[model samples]
Target: MILRTSRLDLREMTEDDLPALRAILQDAETMTAYEGAFDEEMVQAWLHRMRDRYRDDGFGMWAVVLRESGEMIGQCGPTVQHILDEDVLEVGYLFNRAHWHRGYATEAAAAVRDHVFRALGADRLFAQVRDMNVASMNVAIRLGMTVRGRFVKNYRGVDMPHLAFAIDAPPTGREHGVSAAPPERRRER
Candidate 1:
């Protein structure tokens, strides 16, 4: 499956994307929210886990490829997260540092948000933003989300404060559809 936007094509990642994945996941600055860069083994496990999510959940963070360049510039989409003792579907976005400062995160996330509300028939979408990461918070805000709660997440051996952000599906059951661009997909294998 491929979710297309004005400039990106979000699709299921394959093992062949390892090198590109490393460039993003293994970069220290780009992964500060993850606590630090991942080592070779951790990176491999991350990729395998995403593929597993595809098989088990039918959706996961996708490879965000720039259509013009065909380079995987980031990762964005939804994942089921256990937050505050509740299992919620959350939208997530992470980009290579080189691609920061542009509006890609917002564009990609909004597309995924719309898809969940429209195609997936979800009533609400969520995002868990690390307290200090205002940039990511901004992306969630741009998707029309507002902080709904907070919690401490123990990840990478540290207690991280996170703000839960969420937006309900518009009453019309759709938005203007920045991400409503048709996707090219075959039956899941």
Candidate 2:
């Protein structure tokens, strides 16, 4: 499935995307905000795992490509995280250093949120961002998610502070400054 925003085209992962994904994941600067850098083999395995996720779950990370140049910038979408207990669907994203600060992550993430709510009928969507990753936290906020809670997340065997943000259900008419009409029985003639 392809999802398009004003500045990006989000599509499923392909074997051809392995190289780009590897480069992004292996960059120390980029991966520093995450667990750590991944080896080439690990990167390939991650690609395969993501592909499998799409087949089994019907939704997974999407490759964010530049619409005009067709360049694969990074990935953003939903993933089931088994943390703090049971499973939870979390919105995650990663971008190459060059693409940072361009609002690509925010744009792509908003598209994914809409797809999850409008298409997948998800009741809520959440994100787990590391405490020091201020940039990622900003992206989550821009998506209209409020901080739900905090927990200790073990990254590379090191316990780190993590924040959870979530959006529950779609906005109502009142929230959007519009009045909802009553049912036919309650409507006036």
Candidate 3:
């Protein structure tokens, strides 16, 4: 496992994970922020891009799996993002609808936040949340990020207004300025 939480595992996604990824990416309800569900071709391209990211940057969106059942519940991690003309490392999370409202997004993301800070040598981390995605915004907030700016993102032929949320890595790890606790263990990169 790349990183571990009390109830989850964050690791590289493989070709075998396509079906699990489809269950998350192809569901309309789960992909609302993405401008709707992805078709087969889009899903394939998404996987290929992530694989490329892993090879080139050593990290990308990872499979968030339930430790107890070994089931892939979501995708969450850092990716190279261009927000407001500057390339930044942004953490993102998307889960199956069945896993919604369960704190998994926050948990997985917190682990990733900690991992990126400790392992990736990142001084600041970001999350670009679509303006209307309150659920995702909340996850970013719980990760201790505050709105830094705003920008418009064109994706899937839609021009989306997004909020840029960010936080600097804290030396104490408890300075997140939010109530949610970081996972007990997220040691591996």
- Candidate 2 residues 1-189, lDDT tens each? 479999899889999998789878999889986678989888888888889999999778889999989999999989888645658888899998888998999999999888888888788889888879999999999999999888887766789888888888786466666556655643664
- Across 51-113, the per-residue lDDT of candidate 1 in tens digits comes to 999999989999999999999999998999977679989998999899998899999999999
Clashes of each: 0, 0, 0
- TM-score, every prediction: 0.89, 0.87, 0.90
Number of the top lDDT candidate: 3
lDDT by residue (119-141, candidate 3, tens digit) is 99898999999999999999999
The model with the greater TM-score, 1 or 2, is 1
**Ranked by lDDT, top first:** 3, 1, 2
Model 1's TM-score against the true structure: 0.89
**lDDT, each prediction:** 0.90, 0.86, 0.92
Root-mean-square deviation of each candidate, in angstroms? 7.6, 3.6, 6.7
Candidate 2: worst-modelled 10 consecutive residues by lDDT: 180-189
